[model samples]
Structure formats: C-alpha cells, structure tokens
Target: MKDKQVLEFDLIIAGGGAVGCLLALSLRSCGLKIAIVEASAYACDSQQSLHPGFDARSIALSHQSASYLQQLGLQSSLLENCVPIKQIKVSDQGHLGQCWLDHRQQRVEALGYVTSQQQLGTMLYESVKDADDIDWFCPDSVSDVKQHQQHIDVILSSAKRLSASLLVVAEGGSSPTATKLGFQSQVQDYQQVALVANVKTDHPHEFRAYERFTAQGPLALLPNADSSFGLVWSLAAEHRDTFLHMQNSEFLQQLQQAFGYSVGRFVALSQRNSYPLALARLARTVAHRSVVIGNAAHTLHPIAGQGFNLGLRDAQCLSTLLRNTVKQDGDPGAAPVLQVYSQQRHQDQSLVVNSTDALVRFFSNNHGPLVAGRNLGLGLLDLCGPLKLKLGRAAMGYGGQNAAS
Candidate 1:
C-alpha cells in the first residue's frame, strides 16, 4: 500500500462559504500558509451555480463590515455591484408607530449596502485565487480531525492528510466536523421560516430599506441595484408552503395586503426560496488546537439583517488576533490566543443573538398588552433623537465598543 501524501499548512479552514472565504482572505497579510477544504466544487466560472450559500439571495452588509472587507482589498470589486441604503423606514402595520433612520443624521455616507451573495462570494474566491500564500482545495472536506501536542492532523475525504498549527472551522451551523468533535449548540427554533425573493415594483426604491412588522411577522424590503427590492418575509412555518405553492398573482396580492404600498405596487417577483429561522450557538467556541468562527460558532436570527454582519465581525476579530500571534512567533492555536478571541467575541455575539431573539418574539406576538407596549416603545424611539441614533448605530454594526475589534 502507498502512504498517503501529507501536506502542511499554518492554518486549515473547513468550509468555503462567505465567512470561510473571508477568513482565508483576511489572513492573507499574515504571511502564514493557509488551506481551505470545501465540500462543494467551486469553479471560478460557475461558483454561483455550485455553491448553495452563494445563490440569488441578497445580503445586507453593514458599514463596519464593508470597512473590514476594504481593509482586505475587496472594496472596488464588491462595492461596484452593491446598492447603498441611505435610509431605513421601520413601521408597524395597523398601528400609529413608525420610525425612520437616515444616513445624514448619523453623519455617514450610507447606513449599509446590499448585494447578492453570489457577487460577494465570487469576489472572495477571485481574490484568493490571485494570492500565492493560500491553497485552495475545493470538492474536498475534512473527514476527521485529531489534535496532537504540537499540531492538528486533518484527514481529508480524498485519503490525504494535512498538518496545521491551528484548525479553524467556518463551515457554518450544520458543520459535521463540529458535530463530530462533540460541540454542543444551543438552538432556539423561532418556529418561523423566511421567504426570500427578488421583487419589482411600480416605483423605484430610491436607496431606501423598509422593515414592516405585520400580523404574520417582519417583512423587509432591501433596495437592489437594478431598481428592484430584495424581499425577506418571515411567516409561520405552516403558512410557508401555502405561499410557496401559490401562483404568482395570488402570492403578490397576499403580499400586497400584508405589506402596504410603501414602495408602490408589486408588479413582479422572481423565484422564491424559504429558510427555517433559528438562533444557534455552539456551547464552546475553542477546544485544543481548533476554533469555530462565523455561523459555525453562532447563528443569529435575520430580524435586523445581523447574521452575516455578525459573522464578518467574527472573521475580523479572529484574523486580527491570529495576525498578532504570527508577529509574536506565538502558537496560533495556543490556549491564551484562543481565550482572548473567545472572551472578546462573547459580548458582541451574546448581544446580537439575544437582541434578534427579543425582536422576533416581541414583534411577532399579537397580544393586546404586548402590542400596545411595543407600539409605545416604537413611538418613543422615533421621537427621541439620541435614542434613535443609538439604536440606528447598533443596527449599522457600530453600537458598543466591544463590537469593534
């Protein structure tokens, strides 16, 4: 029998989704050799069709997240395909409560930017392909991981072994490696599913985003570059199939009734997709020479478009810490290094997860007292300038000092 080939790297990353790719790219300047093992085949020409995470779904990138990507030298490629969100209009249906957040009030160019997941993933893949320090392994995955005193050994499905000083799992919430390693996650099923699609209206969005709380759930419309809007409508799980199977005209009519004519008439809608909403967090983020980041560490509800933004923050923090470790000639997976990363990320992760959960629970309830109290709170938030600005900043991923790595 022939001995399996053994490869060596400073870091071995599992999964090649946005978060995984971002981590690989962010660590480029660190001068450490890195390799990414992805289960799905990724071809530069067909990335969108091959990767499920890089489908037609749109993502809202916070200003802070854009800054981090810019630092990694991806601003030009990504921003060109993005639509700036100059303002956000938040309201409650059949209520007198409404709030608006404008970029001008926050003294920023824009609150956030919206772009399709495929575009961003393509940019990340292209950037990584041009780099010489990183190794790309697509159509491959880590079958098992074993920790040793000096390094971790990753057995690949292709019968190859990779030795790395540190193992980072950015494989997202359903990572098999995390499960095999005995990582426990705290999962809270929101009992809601989100229906996402690209929709066109009679009037242009004018660089505005809308979040309307309806009797069903929260319905969000993000402005798209092509004068359409990206729709994320949260509804009860039992009702999801009904809308999914409905004819386009009927679906649009129901959507129109739920969401008022804020952006004009819903003239058209593209193919619709549904995703179960849940808040999942790993019990422990770091163990031995391995660490989990991004969705693999914590997955948040998409209430305020915070899941991917929170993951970007995770990549930023971990990459920064790892870069510093390389500079000090320290172990990337050392206990001290992992401890600092975990401790620093605890507050932001907790805040986003809990806040998103609270929003979904409070806004989705139709009880009279709860409804009255929430409406009153919304009214006060709109009336108070300082308080509104604070909440806006938080939503824009710039709330607390801890959020900034």
Candidate 2:
C-alpha cells in the first residue's frame, strides 16, 4: 500500500503537541486513516536538561481529566511522575476568609495531579508511537494550506502536499494554521506575566495547593512530590521585566514575603521563566474542513491551571464524537457532524473560558471594595458545607456534565 508520489489520509492534524498526539491515539482504535504533522523534531527525553521545552510550568489536572487519561491507558505512565493534589486552599493574603477543597469529599483518593509540561508531552508522544493509523511526520511543518469543497490540502515545508477530509490545529498561541482556516481570536492583554519556578520546601506541603491573592495578582504555589513546590506568580506586565531579572535569592525572598511561612524555607530553586498571560478565544470552533483545538482555540489565564486540562477535554470529546460517527458509517469531517460536536461541547468549554477569564479579573484588582467583597465571599463559602463540596467537585473538572471529549 505504499504510494510513490503522494500520501492521502482521512484526517491530518497540524500540531502534534499533547492534544494532537492523544487525539490521534484515541481515534486510532476506530476505523480511520490519520497523519500527524509535528513541527518539532523529537517528542520526548527522560533526561530533564536534554529536553528544551519542559519549562517550569506545571499542570493541575482535575478528576474527570484523570479518568479520561485512565480510559486512554495513560494513567499508569503519567502517575510515575505525577504529584497528587489532595486539596486546594484559596484565600486573600492577610485576609479573614479562606476556603479549602478536599479531594476526600469528592470520593476520590486524589483531587488531581501535577506534572511538568515536558513530561506530559513526552508521555503523550510515547503513547501514540505505535498507533498504526497515524503517520506521524515529525520534524515537519505546514508550509501552506488550501481548502476545497472536496478536501483540505496542506503543503509541507519539504514541498510535499498532503490532503485530508479534516485537520486539527494544535499549534501554540495564535496559530497561523488556525488563522488561515478563517478562525478569529479575541485577545485580552491581561497586562500580566506568569513567573514560574521550582523550589525545595522545608514543610511537607502535604499535597495541598495554595492560591493567595496579593497586590500584583494571584500568587499560587502548587505542590509537587517530595519536599518541593511549583510557583505561578502573576504580576503586572509593567513590573514583569523587573521580577524576571531578579536573582534567585532576591526572587525567593520576595516569594517568601507573599507566601508567608507556609512553605517553610524555599531552597535549591531552579531558574525562573516569565510568560505573558492572555485569553485568546476563537470566534468559532470549526472552519472549512479544519477545526482548532488546544491553544489554537483558546489560551486562558493560569490562575486555575485548567488551560492544558481544558485542551485535553477537547481532544477526548472530539475523539469520542469521531469514533461514534465512524461506527455509524459516517464521514467524520462532514459539516453537520462537526457542527454537532462543536455545539454539544460548547457549554463546558465556554464555562472554562469564562471562569478562567473571570477569575483573573476578579482577583487581579487591588481595589479596596473588591478585596473586601472577595474575602467575604470566601468566608461565606468556607462556612457553607454543601457549597464547599460543590466547589471542590467543580474545581476537579466535574463542574458541568462529565469530562467527555
């Protein structure tokens, strides 16, 4: 079945990041032809330094997200490096109100888990390595795109053109491919930057994650395994350059001030990374025969760490839709089929987009009244048992419906 000149596929995914690879694997068991175009040359590396993109950014996966990975047989592999999240503590720094989300109440051993960006990416790549249905064209780039009534064609950087009925764009923020497919993004300059690093803590942290609001923005310390924790401190962009240039000692001292004595001594710290924070939402989900997924569709604030998990949910749901459609002898890329998938998955997706957006605006304001109001709400939530449980479940990715797609 080797074609000498051109290769054709039922689906061609442009970004082979976490979501793209997982999407291909999820649908591999289904009857479909697939090809993955990854811009990067290599997918994974066991050694940390050898991997270029791991960065310091980590993820806090919710329950439904965990179950989705479990269903995909990636749970075991992921758990090897994951840090279980037992609870989340939310409060306004130096304020009276606080709320705790306990995983035990949600009938789960762990609320969620934390893993590095590079580790997650590597695990996903390995998971899809043997998927026979997907022809992973790594060290490849999408040079050009053309949409015809019959098929969508992608010209590779190598000057080879490939055609498919559907294309999933998983590239990074403001993906050119998504834009070419008529996707428009609503960008909000939060005027903030996220500063991330890993630090050794004296206290156990007890697998408890903390979200504290300071004058600059939301300061979160997500617990990792051992006596270490990861930091995602959102600061005003006007002040980012200053903080980004601070020596490790100076930065740790400032972090200690905002973090108080919770994490004990922060030591053996790694280098810091600063990323501009913004929310880019696509006006529509699908355009022509191409659909945007992951960061290509939306980029949310890191306040809740739901950015990546939300993208994973998209992959799961989309794969489910395609699998069911193919079982019915249907073309997975038909406009009618794509429309249904977009609509059914809209509410949950929108909720995440809106909630993350609201969270940043809600906590970023340093005004007096807003601060008081937020603290009062936190106190009220802390006192309300049923409400607290609901919040816990919601934060664990079970807020609306199930973690389908």
Candidate 3:
C-alpha cells in the first residue's frame, strides 16, 4: 500500500474476539481513533461459528467481571441471557470433606454469572459496530508490526497498512502477531484435556455450580440459562479419545458414577468437544509502543474460571490509563503510560496465574497425603467463616483489590 493509502488511528487493536472487542468498547468514551483488525469474518448469526473464539462454549463471569461490564453499560443487555451462580459446591469424590459457598455469605447477589461466549461476543461486537470513532478490519489479521519511537505500523493479512500510536494484541494466548513482536510466554502443559458439553439432568441446576475433584481431575457442572448444565470434565490426555468416542449413554453412566447423584442422573448431552489445558503467561505485558492484553498476555487454567475475568481487568485498567492520558493530552503509547498499566496489573495477574496453576497442580493428583490435606483444608474452609469469606471474595474477583479500576 502507498504511504498515502495507509490508514491512521490513535489506537489499533489486534483480534476482535471478546477481549479485543471489550477493550475497544471500553474506550468508546475516550474519543480516540480506534481500529480493530480481526482475523475471522463475523457472521450475523453466531451459529455459523465464523468467528474463532465466539463459539458455543460457555464462560463464567465473576461478580467483579459483571460489575466491570455494568460499568461499561453492558449488564442490562447481558443479564437476561445469563444464569446467575447463587451457590458453588466443591468436594473431593469419595472424600468426606467438602466446601460450600453461598451468595448470602459473600454478601453479593450472586457469585458470578454463566453465559455463552458467543452471546458476549455478539454483544460486544454490536456495541462497537456503529461507533463513529471505531473502525473494523474483519477477515484480516495483523501480519507484521514495526514499532517506532512515536507511533507503530501494522500490516494486515489483507495487505492493508495502518499506523497508530499504540497496538494492543488481544488475539489470545497463541497469537502469532505477539510471537512476531517477540513476546515470550512461560507455558506449563497440564497433560490433560477438558471435555466440555451441555448436559441435561433429571433435576434442575437451580443456579448452582459444582466442582468435584476426582482422582483424574476436577469436574465442573455450571448451571446454564436454558436450565441445562454446562459440564467441564478434565481428563488425562491418554484417556481423552476413549471418553470422547464413548457412546453418550455410556459416557453419562461414567459421569454419573464419578459425580454421584447429587445433581440427579445425567440423561442427555450435546456434542462433546475437548481442549488441551495449559497455563501461558507473559513476563511483561508491554513492550515499546505495543501492549498485549487478554489471553495474549496470560492464559490460566480453567479450574478457577479466572481467565476471562482477569483479561477484562486488563482492558479496564488500560482504558482507564489511556483515558487519563487523553485528558492530559499525552500520547497513549508513551512509555510512562504503558509502564504504569503494566505495573498496576502486575499484582492481580500474578495472583490469578499463580493461584490457578497451584489449584490445578494440587487438586489434579491422587496422592494419599495431598488428598487428605486438601480435604481437610476444604472442611476447615467451610467451618471457618473468615477464611470462607476470603475465598468467596477471591472467587467473586475481589481478592486483588489494589488494582481496582
């Protein structure tokens, strides 16, 4: 593209998935010129599944995440389709120790809300679709990036060139552009796969969620808006194929045997999909005039459901910093601005990453002593009101309160 043909903006966002879109929408009031370059072409209906991350997969939005979205004016639109998680029950299969969390104890209306990724994606997309200050470059991706002292240049897969004060990569953990930009992530392979599906049971979920840690791994059943349960069962990598290929009835039998009849019999299930689990985190989320956000910066294990919530906080913090920069008429991509953002987010990022990794490693094993210790810990947590409150606050996304936006 000719120099004259290169588009210009104050900010350029790579990846138009949930986190990217949320970041863009979060800055709508900042009056900055924004462009979103998405690799996948978005379809009118989410069922077509054209967008990569906006599939039927369910996601948990912690109370803090919901509040953040509400601050961005998204709660009213999303609440109708969301199923509130009023309570959470955690137990170790074949163990007597258990822990229960209730909204009443936490002093929150609900611990969190469960909604499909597609729903949140569509809402975020729609919010920015018609914004005068925002532009979309769908069906295109950031192929290369060059950061200059004052501005950054981006070349899209479609051969379009753009210049911006800053570049934010929200393309997720496996982002190619982030790799090209020299962002290194420390990754830990869990040696497990998560089997996800929507399951119908004989009894209603009643806005309750269950986390049952078995010898193999943790199994979670989160209530869905349709009254079905969204199931995420972590299995050893070697057994992934065996379970995925099993007949639905047989799989249900195995599931029932493992999870017990607490939620009643699992009668039917939707299509099953499996994702390899891993923990990926960048030591530094910012470099020069560019910054990495969302999964591109850190991807945590799903045991705590803190992945998206943490990313949302990244967006929120970055937006707040950029808005302040705008108010001061300063460059959004200035090193000082980016450094402050990285600094403010460091504590929370470490808390979630380390804690989630710890949970995965600690609970996924069947060691005789460790199992007993965890069970005892859970039992003590239930009996100890102060400790339980702390856990509940963490679960509600307030554990790292220092970085609150």
Candidate 4:
C-alpha cells in the first residue's frame, strides 16, 4: 500500500458495480496500484444489508465462466450457496414441446451453474475487504474526465481529482459517462420489459433451468437451491404494466399460466423487479486510455441469462490482454492495445447478441406459419444429434474464445 492516501494508480475504474469491482479485485495479486471511483459511497447503512442467503437475480454461468471465476479465486465460497444447473430444459407451453440438455449428453461434467448475482458480489466484497492494493470509492461519482497520452484525470462530484494510466467503465448497459466519452451504442429496445421474481414450487426443480417460449415473450425459470424457481418473465412493454399491477392472487395465476407446471405449484415469490429489455452494442469497445466492460459495453436479452456471462467473458479477456501485454513490456492503455481488446470482444459478443435476439423474435409471435416452422425446427433439432450438439455447445457459450476461455 502507498503511504500517501491521494496517489495515482495503474488502473482507475468508474462504477462500483460487480464487473468494475471484480476487475479491480482480479488484478490485485499483480500488486498493481488500482483505485475504483464509485458513484455512491456506502453512505446508507441499508446498502450493507445482505439479503437472506442469495439474491433474487441469479445467473446461468457457463463452465468457462465458472472457470474464469475460479481463476479469480472466487468459486469455492461462491459455489457454496450456488445451485448447479445440471441440465437445462427448453420447451413451449401446452404443446408437449420440450428438449433437455445434460453434461453427460454434452460430454462435459456440468453445463453451468445457477448462481445468485448478489451472492457473487457479496463473496467478492468479502474477499477483497483486506486487499490493500485496490482502493474503493463509493457514495461519490465521477463528474469530469480528461484523457491525455500519459494518463486520465477525473474530477469527482466531491471536487476531488484522481488520475490513472487507464480507466474502465462498467456501470451498466446505459451510462451517461460512457456516452460522454464517445461511446456510441446500437440499442434495440425489445419494446419489452423483464419481470423478475421468485416462486416456491411444489416439486423440486432438480437443478435445472427452463426457457419456455410463449406468444408474449420468453419466460425463464432458473433453479433456486430451495424448492423454488427464480423467474425472469419477459413480455411486450405494452403489457408490462398489467403484469406489474396485478394483485397477489392475479400475479400468481398469471405466473402459473406463463411458467406452466414444469416446476409444479407456485407458493410465493419476492424481490420482484421489472426492467426494460434491450440489446445495446457499443460502437467501439475501447479507446485511447479507457475501456468498457459489463452492461456499459453490451446488454443482451435475458432469454438465455447470458448477460453476466458476457460481461464475465469481457473481464476474463481483458485480464488476459493485460497479463500478456505487461509480460511483453507493452503499454496496457495504448490505443492499439485497447483496439485489439475490442476486436476480440466484438466477434464473440456479436454471436451471443444475434442468437439471443433471434430466439426472442422466433418465440414471441403467434404467426401460424412461423409457429409450424419453429416447431419443425425444434423437432429436427431433437432428432439430429449433431445439430443438437451444436446448439448445446453454443448455448453453453463455446462459440469461440469470446465465450470458452
């Protein structure tokens, strides 16, 4: 640790979200000087309140992503509370349409994991608490930013100036700061909103996640450790309010209608959240002395629950780039360096976004011809081992280095 409190660092990150915080913590063992400029300080005591054992929003993490998390020294404690999604079930309601994917059929130990987004944050937060190298700033935000050949300077809302060789923004999909820094994005509002909640089921989920396509949209029920399914129910934006305002009994009935009986009866749910759905792709993933990770760079449909996986892959790829560069005495924040990082990330993200978006469109309609074609496609996929394998691999995020680390 440096003796002086206000000092420069090798990296300064904007936004204290999971991605940004994980980036700093990942680089800790390198002993590189780093500081995080969080918009909000831990000003509110409520911020420290850890929900039950896990968060409402969970993640479908690929084997590669799990390995990457483990590589960062985070799997043991993280997995302790996480449920292993041994298989994934994709089907439609009432048509007897269903397909199953398991590691054995896929020739892997496990397809992925069902992990709580907040639990991972909590684990990282605890793990990094004693690491003296990475400085965290919360309850404060970056007000002004300046970049030059040598370093980047930032003025916080508190009028404090901080500098670093490189800056990373991992706030979320929509960030004004990233926009001001010349980050233009191609955003497609799904015209839909994802309604998230949890529900206790009569039968155990058996460690499986379901992505059931419907006329309204795709409703996903990911397994919780208990006999419950964490739901990410997406519907057309126009109908979102109806779902939000439904009385408890009405909500449960609609949930039953949307989710179906794969998980049995619904008892109750909590931590309900409604978010606007969209696909936003940044024009350029990196620049002179800064880079974007997490939701700030790209956000995809939750149809596959691959949003965080995409961000985790970004972090892993960026870490590899940084590691390889310093090993060769290359500048970490060089334009060419950042550009390379962007290129590598762009190709991989393209596939994820396209596949997820296509699935959303294919499933969220009632066209007679389209319905028949999709049902045929699903049937064909089930019959053909090679085709099914291809999709399983793709969904498991093995498209390329963009996914499989």
Candidate 5:
C-alpha cells in the first residue's frame, strides 16, 4: 500500500461560495499557498451542477464593495455586467413620508451596482482558477478539522489529508463544519420569509431602486442589468407558500398594490424562490488557529441589504491582517493576529447586525405610533440634506471605510 501524502498550504478556505472565492482573490498577491475546499463542483456551464451561494439570484454590490473588487484587480472584467443604481427612493405604503437619495448628491459615480450572483461568482472563480499559488479541491469538502499549536490539520471526505497555518470557515450559516469545530450561533427567527424573483415592468427602470415599507413587511425593487427589476419581498411566515405558489399575474397585482405604480406596472414575473429570515451570529469568531467569516460569523436580516457587504468586509479585514503578517514573515494564525481581527470586526458587525434586526422588527408592523414616527422620520430625512448624505453614505457601506471620498 502506498503511504498517503498530505498537501500543505499557508491558508485553507472551507467554502467556495462568493465570500470564500473573493477572499482567495484578495490574497493572490500575498505570496501564500492557498487551498479552497468546496463541496460543490465549481461548475459554471449551464448543464453542470448548481452552485448554492451563486445561484440565479441577483445581489446589490454597494459602492464600497465595487471598489474592493476593483482593488482586487477585477475592475475591467467584472463591473461591465453590473447596472448602476443612480437613485434610491424609500417610502411607506399609503403614507406621505418618503425620501430620495441620488448618486450625484452623494458625489460618487453610483450608489451601488446590481449583478447576478452567478456572474460575480464565476468571474471570481475564473480569476483564481489559473493562479499557481491557489489550488482548488472541488466536489470535496473538509470533513474534519483539528487545530494544533502551530498549524491546523484538515481531513477531506475523500480521505485526503491537508495541513495549513490557518483555517478560515466561510461555509455559511447552518454550517456543519463550523458546528463540529465547536462554534455555537445564536439564531433569532424573525418569523418572516423573503420571496425573491426577477420582475419585469411595463416601463424602463431608469436606474432606480425602491424600498416600500408595507404593513406586512418591506419590499425592494432593484434595477437589474437585464432591464428588469429584482424583487425582494419580505412577508409573514404564513404567507410564504401563498406567495411562492401564487399565479404570476396575481403575484404581480399584489406586488403592484404594495409597491404602487412608482416603477410603472408589473408585467411579468419569473419563478419565485424563498428562504426563512433570521439573525444568526457567534459570540466569538476566532477559535485557536481557525476563524469564522462571512455567513459563518454572522447571518443577518436582508432588510438593509447589508448581509453580503458585511461578510465581504470580514474577508477584507482578515486579508489585510493576513497580508501584513505574511509580509512580516509572521504567523498568520497567531493568537494576537486573530485577536486583532475579532476586535476590529466586532464594532462594524454589531452595528450592521443590530440595525438590520431593528429594521426588520420596526418596519414589519402596523403600530400606529411607530408607523407615524418612521414616516415622519423619513420626511425629515428627505428635507435635511446632511441627514440624507449620511444615510446615503451608510447605505453605500461606508460605515467603517469612507469609500465616498
């Protein structure tokens, strides 16, 4: 029998989703041997298996996120397929309070860009695919992980042994690997479900996004590159099945009633998909030589569209620390290095998590006073230029880094 050989690397990322792939791309110039172990096949051809995190769904990339990708050297190839969101209109259903945020007013190119998840994922994967320093283990996953004094050892389901100086888990919420590694997450169910679909309107989108707060939940219509609107409608848990299975025409009618005729009439609808909404987070993100990031560290409500942006920031911060450590020829998984990452991410993570949770709870109700208050606040926000500027900056994911400047 031949002796089993073990592959070694400076870092091993356990998830090949958007976050993990982006992290790998961010570290391409860091001169580290990187391994990405993904259970799903890195298949992009239409006839191949579907990638979970990079499905047919679409996502809004904040201005900061776009800048981060550009900094990672994906500007020319990526961003071309994205549609810019020049303006965002926020309002309450059947109320007079509303506000408009314009990219021109914010002194930036655009507030954000919308693109299909599959395109971004494929592009990131392509960029890292040919790199000599990066190795991909697709259709395989980390079945077991053990942390040691100097390095962490990983055992793949294929019985391949691997060793790494650090292990980063981006396996997402409800990750079995994270659970096996003794990471406990506190999950708060919002009792709501988000129904997402691509919707077509009778008129052009005009590069605008809308957030309408209905009594039941919040509905968002983001401009898509295909000249359609990507709809993310949050509804009570009980209504999940009804909306998911509703006739296309009826669904459009209900959507129109909730969103009004601001974006013109809804003419067509695509297949609907849904997932239960919740807030999940770990008390601590670092454990020994391993660290949890992306959805593994915190899963948030999508009310504010901050979940992915927040996860990307996690990758950005960790890569910064790891790159610096590599330059210094120091240990990337050292306790001090991991500690600094945890401490630095806590503030931004907490703010986004808490505020997203608050928005879900506050906006998903019909309390007379709260409704009046929020509407009034919206009115004031529109009237006050400074407040509008601050909100726009924050919406652009500038809470930590000032991408606006």
Candidate 6:
C-alpha cells in the first residue's frame, strides 16, 4: 500500500456496534483522531435496515450506564424512547423463592432504563457523526489486524489499510478480526438458546421487569415504552424449535404458564428470534498495542441483563484512561496504558461474568436440595438490607471501586 493511500488515526475501533459507537462518542472531545470500521452500513435512522448490532432487540441499561451516556449529552435523545425500570421482581417457577428490588430503596429514580437497540444506535451515531476528530467507516470491516511495536495496521474489506496508535476491538463475540489476531477466549455453552420478542400484555407493565427461572432456564420480561414487554426466554436447545415454531397463542400460553400473571395475560407477540447462550471471555483483554472490549472481551449470560451494561462499563473505563493518556501526551496504545485499563476492568468483568454464570447454573437446576437452597437464599436476599443494597449497587454498575481505579 502506498503511504498516502494508508489512512492514519490515533485510535481505530474494529466494530460499529453499541459498544464501539459509545467508545467513539465517549472520546469525542478528546481531540484524538478516531475511526470506527463497521461491517454493516450506516443504518441508525431506520429499524428496517438489517444491522448486526443495532437490531430490533430491546436492551436494558443500568442506571450507571445511563449516567455515562447522559454525560456524553445523550440523555435527552435517549430518554424520549426509553422505559424506566422502577422495580425488578425475580422468582423461580413452581417455587416459593422470590426477590424484589425497588429503585426507591436504592434512593434512585429508576434502577435502569430499557430501549430498543435501534433507538440507542441512532442516539450514539448522531452524537459523534459530525465530530471533526471522528471518522465512521460504515459498510466496511477490518479484514486483518497486524500488531507492530508502536502501532497496529488494519486492512479493511475494501482493501484499504489504516494505521493507528491503538486498535480497540468492540466487535461482537463472533468477530473474525479477533480470531485472526490469535486472541484466545474461554467459552462455555449453556446448552440453551434465548428466544426474544416483544409481547403485548392485558395490563400495563408499570415499568416493572420480571425475571422468572423455569425448569428450562431463565425468562426475563422488560417493560417497554408502549405498555408492552420485551421477552427474553431461555429454553433448552432441544425445545427451542418447538417454541419458535409454535403458534402465537401456544407460545403465549407456554409463557403464561411459566411466568404466571404478574403482568396480566400475554395478549400478543411480535416475531421471535433465538440465539444460543454462552459465556465467552478473552483469556487476555490486552495484546501488545491492541485491546479487546465489549463482547469481544467478555460475553455473559443474560440472566441478570448485565451483558450490555458490563460492556458499557468497559467502554467508559477505557475512555477515561485514554482521555487521561491524551492529556498527559502519552501513547494511547502503550503497554503501560493498556495494562492499566486491563487491570482496572478485570474485577468488574470477572464479578459480572462469574456471577451471571453462577446465577444460570444455580437457578436453572431442579434438584430438590439446590432448589431449597436457592429459595432460602432468595428469601434472605430480600430480607437483608445490606445484602440487597450491595447486590443492587453491583447490578447498577456502581459497586466496584476498582473499575475506576
């Protein structure tokens, strides 16, 4: 490649998904030249467009994550389309164990907010689209990543080469660039698939989220802005086809049977989609001048709805470190800077990943002893103020000090 033909940037983000976009916006005011290479075309304005990351799926954002976005001047745009989650009710099917968490108890207006991925993507894209320091390379993907001593060379699908002082991979768990760069990940299949769709109920949701653990797996119903709920039902791989192919009424019946009538009857449902559940984490987040974040760094179970929240935290912490690096006239991709970012993120990532995995294993089983223990534990968690407070803080992405250290 000719020197002039190669584009140069201070930071090159490998994906244009939620995390990648958030990172770009987070560092927008840092005055560093940043480029985001996305495989999907720029489709932030329309939900009809098929973008891998910005889909019709609704995402739950922790209060802390919302605060981060607000800091980036996205509060007004996002709040218009979001549903505040004032309360969360968790229970096990056919069991007496239950726990309720209220935002009031935590002295917060809401525990979190739920918004469609499309809306969030639009907000993120609009926030940095016109920034002079940021370049969005949509409809292009990083085909290869070559790490050098001080910078990384990225080859795009368009046969264009770019050099950057830092290469941050925010691609999803199935990123080919991560694989081609020899980044090793520890993966565990939950033997389950998540069926997701939007459902209308007979009664209003009242901004309450429900987490019901059934014999098969966990099912979450997040309140939506239209008085409906976004359903995330985890089913064993063997039964996914049956549920997916069932008539709407049949599926609603099964969902009602499993979830009770907490939010009234499920009157209708949109198109359903399923994806396998797994716990995937890169063995190491930092490699030479490159780093991995978001799903590329750690992909967790959806039992607690922490996957995106955790990824947002990853972006937030990295952005803080990078901002400081720029202020100090240091290389963004230096080993010391990357190591600090990695260490700061380790605790938060491990806590959320392991806890989410444990929740899946503990709640998915039907063994009598385990069931009894989980029931007792839930009761205790509900009755214990300090324990509940700690759990709530963690869920809201405010528990760990090491995340900012």
How many steric overlaps does candidate 2 have?
3
- Local lDDT at 168 for model 1: 91
Alpha-carbon local distance difference test for all models: 0.87, 0.82, 0.90, 0.77, 0.88, 0.88
Candidate 4 residue pairs that clash:
39-140, 40-138, 40-139, 41-138, 41-139, 172-295, 172-296, 173-295
- Per-residue CA lDDT of candidate 3, range 141-249, in tens? 8888988888899998889999999999999978898898899988999999999999999998989999999876899999988889989899999999999999999
**What would the per-residue lDDT of candidate 6 be over residues 1-405, giving only the tens digit for each residue?**
437888999999999888998999989878789999988887444536546677778889999999888988888987898999999998989878899999998999999999999788878877777989988888898888888887889999999899999999999887788887888888999999999999999999999999998877899999998898999998999998999999999999999999998888999999999999999999888888888999988888888998998889889999999999999999999999999998899888887888889999988888899999998999989999999988888878786554456
Worst 10 residues of 3 by lDDT: 43-52
Q: What is the lDDT of residue 148 in candidate 4?
A: 82
Using all chains and alpha carbons, the TM-scores for the candidates as numbered come to 0.97, 0.95, 0.98, 0.92, 0.97, 0.97
Worst 10 residues of 1 by lDDT: 43-52
**lDDT at 336, model 5:** 97
Residue 295 in model 1: lDDT:
90
| Candidate 3 positional error at 72, Å | 1.3
Candidate number with greatest TM-score = 3
**Residues 1-405, model 1: lDDT tens digits:** 212577889999998889988988888868799999999887545523647778878889998888788888887976898999999998888898889999998999889999999888888877886678888787888888888888888999997799988999999887898886778888998899999999999998999999999988899999998999999999999899998889999999988998888889999999999999888899889998888888988887787999899888988888889998999999998889989988988888888887888999999999999989888988999999999999889978976445336
Ranked by lDDT, top first:
3, 5, 6, 1, 2, 4
Top lDDT hit: 3
Cα lDDT over the full model 5 = 0.88
Question: Per-residue alpha-carbon lDDT of model 5 for 292-315, expressed as tens digits?
Answer: 999999998888888999999999
TM-score of 3: 0.98
